[model samples]
Target: MWFRNLLVYRLTQDISFDAERLEAALAGKPARPCASQELTTYGFVAPFGKGEDAPLVHASQDFLLIAARKEERLLPSSVVKDALKEKVEEIETAQMRKVYKKEREQLKDEIIQAFLPRAFIRRSQTFAAIAPKLGLILVNSASTRRAEDLLSTLREALGSLPVRPLSVKVAPSATLTDWVKAQQAAPDFTVLDECELRDTHEDGGVVRCKRQDLTSDEIQLHLSTGKQVTQLALAWQDKLSFVLDDKLVIKRLRFEDLLTEQAEQDGGDDALAQQDASFTLMMLTFSEFLPALFEALGGEEIPQGI
Candidate 1:
């Protein structure tokens, strides 16, 4: 099985200057007694936004570190490819700034033109010392699942499933009912339940839910739409119960009386997009880290709007 942990983090305190140092560490090998290795430096090529003439102001100092290894390669191509793709997206957005000022913000023409057929984008950066290197990486003091551990756990769990999954959309929403909704439609289906793993105190957090109690109005919303699902149970304070549906979880849920032994299962891929406008890496580790960090920074969580 192939996997690596992506330690996405958000910095706690603001880093003011364009960073040339950390990149070295991420991309370079360790320093020798007589000579120093080159520092790895990642760059924020450009920024773009809808209806903006010039690129929206963006911090150039921020950085991202992707820790990944393939089911095959020494360095996970997933990380390298993901990084390269991001750079290209940034470049395209930067190149398309002018068209955005016009009435149509999509810049359809730019999208068509940005990728030159013969003139492919060749991206390679070289700088001496200080960037995220392939060896000895440091995370922003916040990481729970590395790519390897997470993917392995997922693979084994999937193997044990009684049946295989077919794809569609909308498996679940709201983290509370993840278990009950993962099983449905032998060949194809979607359920409505979400996973809210934001680390914080809420009146009705999953902590309050009885895993055996998958009979909420939210869970039944599926039956209303001609779908069937087996609700997985959750312990009040358990690790993320994604796939694998840990039998231990069932055991505990049984003890807590949360499982209904006679239900079916159904669920699938989640909708994920880069979380925020800024690229502060540390807080990105936790779903709630950003919101909490902002408050600590004296900024309230403002709802996005015009």
Candidate 2:
């Protein structure tokens, strides 16, 4: 359960549900398959897709993952529209009269219904975890819409989930630009070899650099042209390396050397043991990283039960 991208949010209110309570709530509305007429369906499911009927909410000691599963039919709009048009034309030709707009729309709906049953079904799962101790919800998806969809599913299951985008008092662009200018990293962070610089104004341009020295003259030229650092590659205390964006989403996260060490220690066998060790390692690391990140971004403490 490694996460490549992070869509993070701050839980405005405390969630104090024990494992049993959360499981019961999720069971009340489990994931169901998409019906013939339904285009899409969403609900909770197993985090790792383990077991026949995996628990709706996978709860560990410090973390709980609420897995959201969505099944959608692959019915192309143009295909349906073309088929409807052809059918409408056949009917109009038979009667020797042009079909009205309302009738054409009705035919379109009918065609969709007729084809819905034969449409291919696509399934997707997105996982989001709640660290109540940290008062944060971390989504594994990079897409904001997907993350919001998962949050909406959680809201339906739990009745309510008060959350907001994590905000920091300091301007990320300013801090990042300063770091690049000084050719140094922020406190507790080490600047890496990738970054994205963009203009702060509307319709501004962007420059992306990978595996290039950020302190080079070319990057300095962009900075001189009022292009602020919107994203930066950073290594946090040598444990985690990722691209931290202006939006505060961490992408391309790499747990340096941990996986290698784990594999070597386990002799690269026993998949289950490896999974457990990796999960434990990630949980331990993030428990420290999250709060430290929040502090580095000039975030204030969120009072309990707010």
Candidate 3:
């Protein structure tokens, strides 16, 4: 499946596991429903949602697709507070004494335990593509915290995951600002119409533009006033489009018709086959795109000693 957002990381070491080994490792902490007293539970799940018997790791063309599922009991704080208040009032009235802080704390815990089983379960999944050859792992998460949770779980399952957030020698904000100011981008990258500009000064103002000419005088005016581009929309080689932010996170990723059409032609009628085809195409495309992107940003910042 196509990832909507990319939180890219660079692997520091090579992974040598095959499908079976990786599957067994993931199964060690397979996803399970939250217990009656548990607020949240997280573990690896079948990437294709093909049922419990399906492998948790879906390997294709030396690329591994994995998913981490998190289930949390939805117990709203307001509901808990109202219930606790009622219990506290009831105890005070029936016992003919004011409830103490220690007793109230105990009652709150009891209330939460009683509500846990009846609470609705909110479930979400984070998907990641691990490219061993390219030494990269791209997570489908917009939030860095959520992406780190998935990575932590993966590390626990596999015993180790040597990786760090992808960084480049040049700051992304600087490069983005330069692109908009010059009204030009690196080869194979075209600047789009949407961007977020912010003043370089602390506590300064921010301006967001959508569906407007980024090269126009209006945008130029903002830049002229000491604003820098924090985020910019870009199209890559006519095959992919996305918004790149100062932190190097890619958001609102879309595979263009050029790539999707190729996937459709190669993908067979089978659902699994289609998914596999799409995954392969996406990984291959990123393999090429990321290098060009890094080169455009001055080059990848290799960690010391590696």
Candidate 4:
């Protein structure tokens, strides 16, 4: 499956286990529906959506694909508020006494338990690619919180995960601002027409531009006033395009037609074959793109062993 956003993490040490070992560890915590009174549940799931019989881990070359599924009961706060209000009103009117905070809390708890079984279930999945050779884990989530949740689940399943968020020696904001100021990017990368600029001062202003000339005088004026680029769109060697933010998160990632066309030709009509082809192509591209990106950002900061 294609990932639209990435929250990258670095492995502090080599992964000792193979794909089979990882699969067995995950199988111990397979995803299941939330219980009647449980608000949420989380566990590993089949990455290919090929039913329960499918493997939870999908391996290809040096990369491994895994997915985490979370199921949560949908109990709206508005409904609870309305129900609580009505119950409190009824109690107060019938008993001729105000409903105290303690009693109201107990009532709320009872109401929630009563409604939880009837609440609808919402399920979602997060996919991650673990590259053992590269020592990277790329989570397909825009939110850091969600990415961390997946990592926590993985760590629980594996007993331990020696990894941390990817960091660079150089500040990404500085590099991005410099690129825009010079109207040039590092080799193999082309600056695109979208960026987010923010003043460095506390409570300062922010400017977002889209589909406009980044090298124009208007953009230059903002830079002159001490505004720094926090996010910028970039294309890499005609293979991939994505927005790079100050935190080094990759967002709005898109594979160029050149790469996708090749995958399609190789995959034919089989859905599983297509996914495998696309994933292989994507990982191969990242093998090149990520190193170049690190170099451009002044290289990655290696983490100490756990």
Per-candidate TM-score against the hidden true structure: 0.20, 0.89, 0.96, 0.97
Better-scoring candidate (lDDT), 2 or 4: 4
Root mean square deviation (Cα) for candidate 3: 1.4
lDDT agreement with native, every candidate: 0.26, 0.81, 0.92, 0.93
Highest-scoring model, lDDT: 4
Which tens-of-lDDT digit does each residue in 34-136 have in candidate 2? 9989999988887755665667666666887678789999999899978988998899899999999999889888888999999999999888877888888
After superposing candidate 1, which stretches have Cα over 4 Å from the reference?
Answer: 1-17, 30-306
Estimate the Cα RMSD of every predicted model relative to the unseen true structure: 23.0, 2.6, 1.4, 1.2
Writing each residue's lDDT as its tens digit, candidate 4 over 191-238 gives 999999999999999999999899999999999999999999999998
Candidate 3 residues lying further than 4 Å off, grouped into runs, are: none
Q: For model 3, what is the C-alpha lDDT against the true structure?
A: 0.92
Query: Candidates 1 and 3: which is better by TM-score?
Result: 3
Q: How well is each residue in 167-197 modelled by candidate 3, as lDDT tens digits?
A: 9999999999999999999999999999999
Q: What order do candidates take by lDDT, descending?
A: 4, 3, 2, 1
